[model samples]
Target: MGSSASKAALAATTEEPMEPGPKHLADLTQYINETHMSVAHLADILSKKTGSSSWVVVFKALVTVHHLMVHGNERFIRHLAARHSLFTLHNFLDKSVGEGYAMSIFIRRYSRYLNERSLAYRQIACDITKVKRGASGVMRNMDTDRLLHTLPVIQTQLDALLSFAADPDELRNGIVRAAFRLLLKDSLRLFAAYNEGMLNLLGKYFDMRRSQCRESLELYAKFLARTAKLTRFLRVAEQVGIDRNSIPHLTQAPCSLLEALQQHLASLEEKKDFLCPCGLQHTVTLSIPYRPTGNACARRTWFADYFPYTIFTLPSPQACWSRAAKYGASIETDASGGTNWQLSTCASTSAIWTSVSGPPSPHTVTSTMAFPPLMSPQSLVSSPPGLMADELELTAWAGQQSQSM
Candidate 1:
């Protein structure tokens, strides 16, 4: 009998442990319930430590939900749901600084932590529906698709929050809400604008137009401009991708396309007659006729015609002569003691000069002169100096006149 008892004891010691059954699962559920309560209590303490308006509450709750969704199975989710975790979330949502904004944060966190194919997503979705329905009867009536449709409504509310701010101070104070609004606004608009149908249409249009015809080129320019605008807005959308640091090269696409179109139009043989979308030809000329006196010392006056949307002005014949004399001193003179000076003007394509003759009709000789590069529209547009306030005034006046026309 002692030998048999020893053998049985040895067999028992060698036996493998049995798998956990219903009793173990019940214990696990109890443990999860206790853990969830502890987390809720901690969150309440933290919320009291931080102000109710503080985003910390929202962040902490999001972390809790993420943990539960990622690690907890269906039974754990059911336990959380039974403990009214959704009600806690709903209460937090109500008191939060931006309710819609907070919801978006929750959605993004859930999407990041739980895979759609996983049971956790579906469980969380159901719990979210329940919480949403409890808060609003409208959500209770909604099917899953309809419930998902409310995401845009929340997005629109967040956008309205951003738009309604009177100044930057309001946005500064609500940085979290502002960030959510900015991040969502561009993405929503871009996705709506660049749908599959629009893409297919654009592709077909491109394939149909291969020639350099004016209509085709005009359409191409429009397409490029639209594409550039959409692409620029997509910067925020692309931030949500796995590689956050990688920025798309299309940020400056509009500027590049404009420059390219300008070059292409300039290269065309019929460019002279082609009226650009900007309502100006490739080359624009403004002539100011002036009469020159026999006495080279005399200050000849010329009236400048106003050039639309340009800072260009015709210099007086005396000014031209002064510039010529200044430049001519460094150069060689011809046999007739006449000096030719090459003048560089601010206008991309303008020249000014004086004509002197010894015979009759020499009194009113026309002179074409070029001004300095400093006075060009491009330079003024780029960096208008304090001394160039008059030029800016002229440009503004010209712009008003053109708009009125």
Candidate 2:
């Protein structure tokens, strides 16, 4: 492509979605696809345009990049993915002073998503290449793992795509309008990949890590809620002039469809190994089993005499005795509370125990229990019902104990 022709097409790209009209876009794409233009030259122009102070220019440049990626040459994609710094757009800013161009945040985010998309596509292409090269069946498992890795990348890109997710006001911005035309276009495809891959993961890979599987489902549920919320935004999308054709998937994919998929995933996840919050999912769990024979001020939580499930969250029996001697517990000591994350559940009982002494560990059995805060119903939501009454009764039983174990 002649420098003059390339310059005209770049100049033609303005706020109007069709400004760099199809012909100009076609000719420019042809140059990059056919190698008449160097990928480096296109990269430099895209970098500068995306990094512009004007949000309009940035949005248009992003559209151009999207255009070429969708309709341009394969080499261009590889070059962009490998040379990610060329389009990082991490600090891209919009200095246009107006309420209309409320797209700086959206543009910055969309640009990053595009970068991830490019990288993701490159990985996909590599997998295809491996297949064509007659890669052995051994590569299959490795590829599955790679796709699992890509799941979150796609999820995050989709999240960023919806920066103005349900906000009709922000979605109305001209830059936002143009950006979504392309952004949603890519998102629809990415959404398919994510949903499909998730199904495969749950269906074919039954042995996948429980924590990863559950976390993926939770993230998927988050997307389902967003889509349900997007219904209103989509109605506004048409009122604001976004093409119905471009967002067919966005408008057609039902929330129920996603919900069913989520439930399926959850059911499949349950069939896998159970993940105990006993902290054993990751590293070692410290069991602080405390028996308060002499003290009456400590809280009583997760005091299972049998150590039922061997859940690491349950303090070991012998450890409880040692813990009684070290930290100590009392039924009447006013219980100070801790955040839920700091609390550990007992495998033997459903009660969640908080460590009044230190991090809930082996040193935190019955002897180190922290009682209910304020002794009010609202303050004890995490604990079982009538826990206050039980603690009071237990306190009465302990008040008469000798000052020795």
Question: TM-score for every candidate vs. truth?
Answer: 0.20, 0.51
Q: How accurate is candidate 1 locally (lDDT)?
A: 0.29
Residue-level lDDT of model 2, residues 1-405, one tens digit each, is 568545845775665534346676777777886765567777667677765666677777877777777666777777887873656566766565664244666666777767766766566553221121111221222444665566666666566655545355665544455556555445444444443444344333324454654665554444444443333344455555654433322211112222222333455444423221122111122334432232111211222221221111334434544544453422222234221213222111112233223333323333112211111112232332112221111111222221110
Query: Per-residue CA lDDT of candidate 1, range 121-218, in tens?
Result: 23434423113111123332443334333433332322332232222222232333323333333233222222221222222221232233233345
Best by TM-score: 2
- Cα error of candidate 1 at position 211, Å: 28
Residue 390 of model 1 has an lDDT of 20
Deviation of model 1 at 36, angstroms: 19
Candidate lDDT (C-alpha), each: 0.29, 0.45
